[model samples]
Target chain A: MELEALSVGQYSFIQNAYSFGFAVMAAATLFFWLMKSEIAPAYRLAITITGLVTAVAAYHYLQIMLSWGAAVDVTSGEVISTGKPFNQAYRYVDWLLTVPLLLIELILVMRLSRQETIKRTTVLGGAAALMIVLGYPGEVSSAGGLRFVFWVLSMIPFVYIVYQLVVGLKESISQQPESVKNLINISVYLVIGSWLFYPIVYLFPLVGLEGGAAITAVEVGYTVADIVAKAVFGVFIFMIAMRKSQEIEGTASTVSKPAAAAENETSKPS
Target chain B: MELEALSVGQYSFIQNAYSFGFAVMAAATLFFWLMKSEIAPAYRLAITITGLVTAVAAYHYLQIMLSWGAAVDVTSGEVISTGKPFNQAYRYVDWLLTVPLLLIELILVMRLSRQETIKRTTVLGGAAALMIVLGYPGEVSSAGGLRFVFWVLSMIPFVYIVYQLVVGLKESISQQPESVKNLINISVYLVIGSWLFYPIVYLFPLVGLEGGAAITAVEVGYTVADIVAKAVFGVFIFMIAMRKSQEIEGTASTVSKPAAAAENETSKPS
Candidate 1:
């Protein structure tokens, strides 16, 4: 009971660690909202991802309350069984918060890049689906098996995404502004960084590891990293979302200039 | 024993119902693989969504296996608690199948319409997030409460999407092909139809629903609707994705025409 009680001590660290992600998400949402009137086409995907991720982060913050406060009944096993509102609440929040963000990120990349290939999008979508399945409730039951399945499943999307990032970076350099490129690269790297914890989480549980401290450390560390990647860095992605309108306006105006000039020539007193 | 046998029979029906979803999902994946090399950019989002929704339908099928399969042995009063593996597996598959599709649909709309409004995209993404959350395992645990929540959550995204469709139709009347518009309208209607089932599912249990007949009807009906919406209708949406490359190519070729014409005029026997 004492050890279980001590688990509550981690909340402050979590709150502090997660704050950065929250701030980023909130800032990004606001950024998009404020600039709603001026945003352009190319930037639309990025901004949408930013806003959705932020909302997810916000909901995730609430998930901690459900897990620790609501779901944790001392009478039950220290290990929570996802039976009722509490477990469902926790997993539901987790799914809702993260899935769309992943989807948004992939879509943003595909839409922004010059390669708008259907095959590429299909492959990416399939990979992402594998990752999602690996994370679902049924997978959570068989920790070892689920971990193995998901580790393999998640790889399909994760590797494909990295490939996309590289290709997208190359395509973006020619078309997008420097700011957009930098933000996108950082965001992709951050997302990849967050995923690194999956293998650690998967493997640590499998080794019959019972060091309470070590498990806590890994769990907390992963949570913090995810918060930063998806939320804090997510804000920077949002900032780019905010800047989308300017980028589109700039491109459209550039494209429209020739048409405008042609009109001028036709109207001239020749 | 008779009552127990009856319950067992009920559970079996539930399990098989979800199989339909999975079968369609596999079909969807195969469909995309077959068409991977041929589709155009305009149809990318639509095709990806169609493929993913089919996958989601398949995932639901798998989930029925997990949920109903486990229901057989648990004592009547006890909560049918399958371990974490079961829960996570089903939810993960659901997320993998649905989120990217929703995200891609929004991106497709943004690019296809050329409207480029940040507000619209963010709104769409937010709606997608809400739908994803509602579709999560925990969200549907209490068939009664969950069904209501699901209906509301699903509606938000659908309504916002319809708005996007209206705006897109008006904005791109000149540039977009009539075939693309027809596909878009049909896809929207189909998805909306699937969403309508949430209320029916919710209402059935409230109206004292029981037995293989009622449950089978609801489960199978929902599954069929989703297949048509996400897979069959979705295939038509893929056709829409095929139209985009030509438009972009047209822009590239025509935009340079005046420049080429001017250069020819200037070099003419001067």
Candidate 2:
């Protein structure tokens, strides 16, 4: 599909998605920084990484938004050659930095042993980064065959990342306190589920979607996925951190003074 | 200022703002409904009402977004008549339903007596609805004089609402637990601060900003304010509700068994 012009609706959808992404990412960064919690050092590292992922994505999204805004020919509803070309590449740039961090953050919060954490982070993070880098070629390709090839190649790493999350992380997740175990599983599922949309968006043109409608769908779909994967996922991370912190504290108190801890537990409203 | 053509950028900005608003509001509605907390019945009512406000706003925003999307002449970057006229009135409709509910929700969360809740809800809600209704004519008017007239008329109720929030609610807010009293005060301040942006957006043309830039400014500004006023404000409300719930539960347990409660309190990590 040769790229030509976008409808006003298509342009707007794309622009708005970037703007929304920028705002939410920035807000989440600040929130993770400022939120008061007594989580363990490992969990705190996870929070920090989460903030970093958003902060990095936010900066790139701002660039994408401005580029899109500048490219639009207001009088023609056409995307023209702005002096600074519309940088769709920014999305890939963002994913390159943030995707790895996202995986690392999840691993950190699980409080796995140093060796296990290092191994999982390296493998999963590498797979995530490779998936994004591979997808970029498809995202930019005009030929359907070329796009499909790159997309399929990207899915190889995507499948690996999912396997790591669902199968490899199972034992570690099971070790978590009962209160947060389900939440961890849900977070993993959310990442996998929302991510499935990206590939569909990539192949929309191949599937007979073209022009303004296709562009609009792709932009809107990506925006929804980004929000779920980043902001909503961040919220789950924060909750898990808090829950883990409480559990650790509870255990420490019980160990230190059994009688006092029992009385304390009894008094808490069920 | 006669309403004329909108630039591609302007259309996109407006559409994107509405889309962003719709997503956030819908997400917030679900969050308030689904979040597990041990808050009081009164606080739960506040949560439900909070969800209601956002749900209503989200529906209206979708209408506004689609209307804008449909209005655009994709090739010309002009907003043409699409048998379905662009319904700018949807905003007023939203505010009419939500503004009053916003006030009522805040008051409800305070856990005031039934008599006080009804009194405040009626007065504040009425004033809020009137304020939004009065502002509609100004929003639609092309004439500066007519716009200013309705704007000033609307301020009458706006000022009254502000006075009620700050003065009438002062004593009640003060009665909250120490941890949440400041949060309540800050939330009120946040509401006032974010709301001030709306009138500024409404009067941008009066300040000499016109055409696409002005329209973009107004739309973007309004979206930012809405997020802060509704979403961020909702967060503060949640925190306050949780704090109050904790206080009440603590009091009940302490009253039942003083020694155990004290032990529980001391063991809890600050």
Candidate 3:
């Protein structure tokens, strides 16, 4: 991708966003890891995957910050190109690894049947990967038409994942304990809504925003979406897990030890 | 770590070992990956772990080669430093990841019971990690006595692993099918023997050898031990897995798949 020059204000905004994104992701990772033992064994892997997602995002955000520093020149009192490329691919790479993982953590938190879990994750996770792969060509393309082509192509899988989350997982979500059902439902919608934010940002240049404005909007937009999708969603996962564990514990206490394992269907998600 | 300067001949020798080590490890990684499905599902995890060990080794060897290139100045003809430190920690880092994996792969090939598998892997893999970690401080220490102290500390774990492989696994080895019993036993010995070679190499500087010869001996020694320990042992693991699969197939045909799972056990190693 061609590099973009920015005004000092635009440059400062992106730099701050990158720094804040890293801090949020890093914080989420630490939060998940530290809170892991509070959840039931069955839900811990969901938290672990959540941790992994945030950790991967934190690493990429750090990389993006470093790349931005190397590729931008501010010593002249204005933002100028440093003749080195800012690796926009870092965001795509982060999304590629974490998006599928995002779907997986949600699937895990639902405690679906083994075959159902495998089937949904295989289809949905594979779709998430395909969506990202299809989107990348357009992401790096200079031509607006080519970018739009990939946008449409990627949307096929994007829509599939959204549908799978909203409709296909309805049964599983309903079966979750009363305390966590709404939590999961809200988290699912949060994923779909945050993900929708991604493509709109992808269209910044195509929407006639140019140069610094377009780049700034895209960078800041993606940063905001990432925090909402990963960190905020992670907090929701933590909440759902806490609620589910309490459900399991409450049932265990009322019905005695025999019912302890009735709710924790799966030991670990794939 | 203090950097070591080398003679031209020593530099060339160490360089060749680094290059050849990379090729060996990469080739083993490819071989194990390609042959994964050929093994019984029960033993394929062993193959996968083997692949991981070699893959990690390949990556570190590549890093070592790059570090070597950047640290050495060949323009002087006689060996000279570029003032950039050659990172010797790559070897320890590689061991930290792959050594535990090496132990786990062997346990998987044996197909021990779930409890047995978990217990052995926890104890042995943990010991392997401790061995590597303890050795690192000594490897980097300038004082021979301090190095020797760490060596002794690391040996505590090393001997435990060797004993676990030989004496502790005696019953597991005996229960193996006719075809793979000796194969497992031989691989066990191979591990114990190859591991011994590492400490010998670690002691090179403490011995009479000094300067270029000591660095060359240690480098070449560690590289050879790595190939034998990882690549060669991986091949042994592959052979054992192949034999176990064949045993499963042979019994599967006669007993009509009521025994398809007879020899194979534990779907995946941790």
For model 3, the superposed segments whose C-alpha errors exceed 4 Å read A1-4, A258-270, B1-106, B113-270
lDDT of 2 by residue, B90-173 (tens): 666667667787787788777554356657988998999899889987876768999899999999999999999999998777
Interface RMSD, prediction 3: 14.9
lDDT of 1 at A76: 32
Top-down DockQ ranking:
2, 1, 3
Model 2 achieves a DockQ score of 0.07
Native-contact recovery for every candidate? 0.00, 0.03, 0.00
Which has the greatest DockQ? 2
Each model's Cα RMSD: 14.4, 12.8, 14.0
DockQ of 3: 0.04
User: What shift in Å separates residue A128 of candidate 2 from its native position after superposition?
Assistant: 1.1
Candidate 1 or 2, higher lDDT?
2
Q: Point out the higher-scoring one by DockQ: 1 or 3.
A: 1
- Over B57-169, each residue of candidate 3 has an lDDT whose tens digit, in order, gives 99998899789878875542455677888899998999999999999999998888999999999999999999999999998888999989999999999998988888998
Better of 1 and 2 by DockQ: 2
Candidate 3 global TM-score: 0.57
